[model samples]
Target: MEKMKPTLTVIMPAYNELKNLRGAFISATGALKIAGISDYEIIIITNTKRDGSHDGTPYVAEQIVKEDSRVRHIHNNSYVGLGFKFRQGIGDARKSFITWVPGDNENIEESVAGIFRHIGEADMITSYTSNTQVRKWKRRFVSRCFTEFCNLLFGLRLKYYNGICIYPTKLLQKVPTKSDNFAYMAEIIIYLVKSGVRYKEVPMEIKPTAISSSFKLKSVFEALGTIALLFWNIHFKRTRIKIGSIN
Candidate 1:
């Protein structure tokens, strides 16, 4: 007569993160155990450049896979975008719920456990950072602008779009997200929200780290372009066909 706990697949994308991958994996495992999630798998997607540069991460990931049967490694010979890695994880996931934890170790065990504790309360568990002061002023400003712009463009008032969000595997697989950049997270959230999927926003605390690679000028431009394309496709190019309800 008790409700069953949902199984989870934790997608961890590592690109030249040999220093942080092991710690991230430890944190993920600890968090899952803290949340009392007995059924889970961690997929570590490691990437190396075509020229054989950045080779260390794949080796570490493979070692982790060998050490833990619950961990799987998906190696990319060439450097693909993060969005592509995310999609690959989604395709490989075999669980009731799916969420991503970056290999940079920015999300610690307690924060992840906080997010996991709220599972099954809604169709999706969307997280926002409670402490933005942990980041530099420029990064904080940019994040605020991005979130506001997304809200204005999509007419949704969500707290954050790029944080670790938990989605049902089946529901996420149906969304045709087209961004090969960081904007893909926003794209997925927008599509699901527009389709009337219920979501709950939770607050998470992030650890301070060096400037992220995604903060580069090129990535900013790429995200802008992707958002423009998403806007066009969502508003003008196609009709908003409703996916089946999660409820």
Candidate 2:
């Protein structure tokens, strides 16, 4: 008998991405189909402005949920961090594995399909952008610096720390993450990798989008603080425990 394919739960976080939400959903579904993943579901987490206003993204997400039974929608009353949205999706995921795609339509269909194609080959699928020239100079500089800093601090050589990664749902749930901001994924990756979980790195390419929420001064400072705490926790505070041994 042929081997059964693994099921996946895709978490899409949309913050004022009215123009790209539907396209992102369609692209993700298409990529999943291309990768031969038939048993999968998408969870769209929609966010609005601090004043409880949006650009109709929530409505668009609702339409998607209505059009597809595999799609689920979660609306936030105000703007919450990306990490918070992902944590919510992770808790609600009902599949064997979990991954996230941004609703900004930055990730190309081929890259997404490539990531999914490597599913079940390792404990996790970590991706790195092959074409960094697509981003602005400042953003590229910041990203490079961040990746280098993470590698130095963690004593590992990884090309990227914040790309779209796939992890087992139960394993991710068992690991503890404290950051609810953009730096949350970095924290999770460091924890899991340091704990000796096997992972595979894949290359991805992204398209430039109209809006970017990651380069703000506030977000930069928040990420720095979170990394500092994470460094301390990993190097000094926590005991060395392998992820596979976690209960």
Candidate 3:
């Protein structure tokens, strides 16, 4: 039997992201090309219908599909949230490794190579965001408190939950999405910890422009909801299973 080539799947979920899709995709694929990982595909999932302002996300996605044959555009036919689109992208992935990069050009090019390099040793790899001075004091305090609470709640102290996550596709397939919204990332991380999957954290610098444009309040609520769900699973659910070491 011939050996099968390992594939890397990049899931980019977007909402009102027509302006950044092409740049983000070009940067990400360019970095991947430099890493010498030729077996890869980019899945762009858009939920523009729910954004309340027709930003022509779908049209832009179509244009991307036409321009980059390596990219696949998935329309959010049923769901209307970022989490839902991401879940669909993950479910459709047929690759050996999977990574999610924000569609707003936040993820740095160099970190993509770092993630692929570390994936050999860890089941999951996450990157930390660069500190920015433009954030409001209250937002910073809330994020810190929420992050600490997440560490305590899930026993996993990843610097940023949804910032940039890379993991084995099989691991994600084993423990699928429990929530269909923005809480999906948090739920996945908690599940990975509870399952004992070996994970690592690396520091990466995020673009200040991306940070300034992020939806902070909405992200906070999503994280809190994910933490609540994790507590429920720990104390009241029977989803515990052993995940092997990072050997």
**Each candidate's root-mean-square deviation in Å?**
1.4, 1.6, 3.4
In model 3, the Cα lDDT at residue 170 comes to: 67
Give one digit per residue, the lDDT tens place, for model 1 in 86-116.
Answer: 9999999999899999999988788889999
Off by over 4 Å in 3: 1-6, 51-53, 77-79, 132-139, 210-219, 242-247
lDDT of 3 at 139: 51
Cα misplacement distance, residue 43 of candidate 3 (Å): 0.3
lDDT of 3: 0.71
Taken over the whole model, the C-alpha lDDT of each candidate is: 0.89, 0.89, 0.71
- Mark the regions of model 2 whose C-alpha exceeds 4 Å error after superposition: 239-242, 245-247
Tens digit of per-residue lDDT, candidate 3, span 172-224: 77775666555677678777877777778877665555443334687667657
> What is the lDDT for 147 in model 1?
94
Clashes of 3: 0
- The ten-residue window of minimal lDDT in model 2 covers 238-247
Candidate 2 local lDDT, 83-149, one digit each (tens): 8999999989999999999999889998899999998888889999999888888888888999999
The TM-score, computed over Cα atoms with residue i paired to residue i, of candidate 3 is 0.85
